[model samples]
Target: MATPQPRRWIPYPPLISVCASLWWLSAAAASVHEFPTDGTVIELDDASFERAISAFDLILVDFYAPWCGHCKRLAPELDKAAQVLAQLNDPITIAKINADKYTKHAAKYEIDGYPTMKLFMHGVPMEYTGPRNAELLVRFLKKFVAPDISFLESDSAVQNFIDMAGANFPVFIGFGLNESVILELAHEYKKKAWFSVAKDFSEEIMVAYDFDKVPALVSLHPKYNEQSVFYGPFEGEFLEDFIRQNQLPLTVPINSETLKLVKDDERKIVLTIVEDELDENSLKLVRILRSAATANRDLIFGYVGVKQWGEFVDAFDISKRSKLPKLLVWDGKEEYHIVVGSEYLDDNDQGSQISRFLEEYREGKTIKREMDGPSLIGFINSLISIRTVYLIVFIVAVLMVIQNFSQTEENPQFRGIQDGAEGTDASTSHIESCRDYQPVNKED
Candidate 1:
């Protein structure tokens, strides 16, 4: 049998381009996220709005008044819908006529209620009426909106969705009606589920399913896009069960909170993101934390490996890592005093940087850090080794040294003087007498 030959080297000119391309690839591989919400909103008269409605998949019109109670309730719902639409990239054209402000627009739609939704297809009204919940409206609008269900697209592609999915399909969308705790658990495995975080909500989707409460999860189906949705606010175990029930593969998103939790409160935060479950990346971050914690006992050190939503993974909407392990001089919403690698972490002169971060934390600054490098995981096991104990011993030793030095420095002749110099009895000094002396004052 012929021995296998080594592969030929890459050509020169091509290699140069390849190097450049590699550089570009490395830059791109840094994981820049794209948000799901994308689109423009407008508040205009019907005449001006009708022109652009044709291009949009769904043109949702809201008829309302500034003073109506029903309208006020509908306001939050519609705003939520707009936000969801924005996230979906479906781009809803919301024309709010304060029946009193745009009587012409309101009158043209023949609006009876203070709040109403008209779903238009091709610039012509196909389905109309509101007083509906957000999910229902979202569900109802799906028929008209293309479900964009081409799985060939990266799972990262979530700008907009129109599918029977939710409960019926392969995906899950969580709503605000769900509890924060549930969301927190969902967050734990957030990469596993697609969540829609909302502060307010509408019953459109709920009434459609006759279920209430949020942080709801709606499963989706590609064909039944219009009516597909499972209700939820699935928390830790329950959410986990649902995933298992569906036989969904577990997606390990970077558990920002959990990773931060694993750290000793005194450690700094370290963040990392990689293409796979490679230990090289994991060890890189762990080592950095190990070193920093070793150097300074005051740091609240931690390391996060971003698989998804665990803090370092690129978020589709915000397109950034939210939390990482690094000493926090301050508490930022998504930031901290960062240390990128051993180069930055192992600096002998971290005095200014460390102090600044502490001061920042005092002022309640928060930080989300993303860091990389080899030296990161090197010394994690020796973190903050007996630092408190050592500090106490060092202080006591310095005090003792000072006391002994003062005793030895004293001269026999000057001993009395030294005692009298700082002594409580001033009379012992030669300069002063124990008896008081009277002094004459002209005023007396």
Candidate 2:
């Protein structure tokens, strides 16, 4: 929804350096001592053509005619863009190639548009294209120039976002970074969920959205505008409330109201058997479940644990009338849907039991799968954080050092044989008569 404004009239001297390739080496050397001061502009011509393009990793080619109104409007924008990109230390050489003078090269490129900001990687055209505004131009050029992919890919990344988060209808494209997968998954059940959400990272959109320290998720709801989100990490009731509203096809959390439904109502209930200590693997599984449940409705969740009981009760407010680690598909009159903790559905659903649960919830069939590998995979992935894996490596290095030191202390190879060999100490015992005779002759 952003539009390019008319660029202010800026002069071209700052943008038109005579021998830019020669100046760049000096500039790069100085930039290390100081900061990136200013951007160098090279005017490209047919004379030293091939050599100029090779000077930089990325090149922002501006093919413009001085007479055109749009070209004039875009000039100042390009200047501002050069300054911003300089701050990022992007190695894109900004060349204002005179398309008018170099008609052959322009025609070779199939010049269909005016003021086209095409990002060429080694002379071949690629995406990272946009209109003439400096901000947008900087964003377009960043992917090729900057090493880290911190900038947003505009609305183009939406499809991938859906795939990444396992989202469906009414996707939220981070209106203000509301991406926490669990809360968004939870909120989709409330009402007729519609509308998607997304973030507006004035510039650095992708970094802000990566599965980084900032909580992130791409969610979809059944209804177009009824989608929901949790921008930051959530815990206890905030998460439960969001999930409950979404009408997730998974188990409804066990609590006082849920207990009443099992006792006095006609509907069924399904509860996940949470262990005493809810580890990250279990937590990730819950989030993934929340995502898959978007396609289903009717099933409820339950939790049973004496150790983290307070957390469970506070999260969902359940009573401890019947405490069994079971996934009870409670049909109205009596407990009907019972998948015992000891028994598990087999191999076919190694990683997709949550999906199976949703399918069963909607289609009135039971689906259970043993989630061992995926569970362990998730556990490994969780533990493979920056610090934890490094800690393991550190411990291994220390143990190896200790083992080497222990071997060295047990064997001091002074002549190769440590204990039973003929050493210098053993030879000293045989030199008795020769030494005594020499001392006696001298005295005599």
Candidate 3:
């Protein structure tokens, strides 16, 4: 009888099973991510790169070469930004991999240039085209982590939101409007601009933003001190178009980054080429361009300085010998148009000159010309300049001349024939050189 009772075994307690399940969940969560949280820049190799990408919700990876000057400059800035970001409740990791050493990974990411910053969000890679400075970089990266559309319930909340948004991105505040109105656009353009809804705000807020009505969407370009208000009809493409156009400032400084932004835009660029963008005169001219841009939102007004980006300026057939402050309307591609009468701005009255230039551009009184050299290949951080192309051609011509001279020395009859056909052959070679290097006038 005792042996039969012993055969009936007892079950484990229910609490034990509950405890076991909790333990398993905790272990799984820890195993999901073992990333460093000490604000240090994670140096990733091919082995750990995939693990890091999967571990962090948001991470910025800099694909860089050790020998690259730009990469060197970016390192300290990244280090500082990493420290600041680490203090956040939801931190973003800054990482770098030597693209030069990791050939396989570099090729995989199509890392054609050094210091290529890519932000990986939930295993999806997006090119990081934000500012490089530590402070601005932090503000820029914060955009990614921010809510699709922040809801402001108070005036101070609205002001604080604006202050924290920084001047790097355009801020769109929907005053007295429903979240559903801007929810879609907020998600669509989250990366390019900041979107928000002010649930409770007074006329002070309205007047400050220069809007007199409720249900008004205000787009603020803080960096440019510009604000534009949109009153409804915000259902379809009108809302989207307004957001798209206002993403850029009234006048954009034409640089590698800004150029990339304008490339896909349908509007032609009213480009002002100056000697030095940082100069007093150039800055004054930019103000005038901004005013014109405000009035003519259909066209994009941009300026480039020869001192800053000589190659890009040269692409427009501009040189130091040419007049400064040259104005043209570019198709944002291979061709640009110059008003025949207003090719250059007057030093005495730049504002009037710019107005006339815009008028001429609108009236189709302009000459279209192709960009010099190749079709803007690799315009971002271009290694080969127009001058470099010209030098290579010049070298080739010199080598050809040397070869011909050597051939003539060996063959006396060939030299005699060459001399006899001098005018015809010389003219042909000269014309060919001009054709190769000169800007093609499409208007011709």
Best by TM-score: 3
Q: Compute each candidate's TM-score over C-alphas.
A: 0.26, 0.29, 0.79
Candidate 2: where is the Cα deviation over 4 Å?
A: 1-37, 146-444
Write candidate 1's Cα lDDT for 1-444 as tens digits. 999999998779987999999998776444221111243335555455544454454567666667667778777666666666666545554445455576675566665555555766666774353225767666545434443222212222332333332432245444444345344544444423333433443556456533476545555333323212345434555555454333221121224223332331333332323333346644554444444444443333433334433223332111234323233231212333432232123334444544455455545454344333323332221222233346778999999999988886775667777666777765455345534555779699
Cα error of candidate 3 at position 182, Å: 1.0
lDDT of 2 by residue, 356-433 (tens): 554455554553433223324423532233334667889999999999889888777843674447666666654654
Better of 1 and 2 by lDDT: 2
Candidate 3 lDDT over residue span 378-419, tens digit each = 373364434356678899999999998898789988777876
Number of backbone clashes in candidate 1? 78
* Candidate 2, run of 10 with poorest lDDT: 186-195
C-alpha displacement of 108 in model 3, angstroms? 0.8
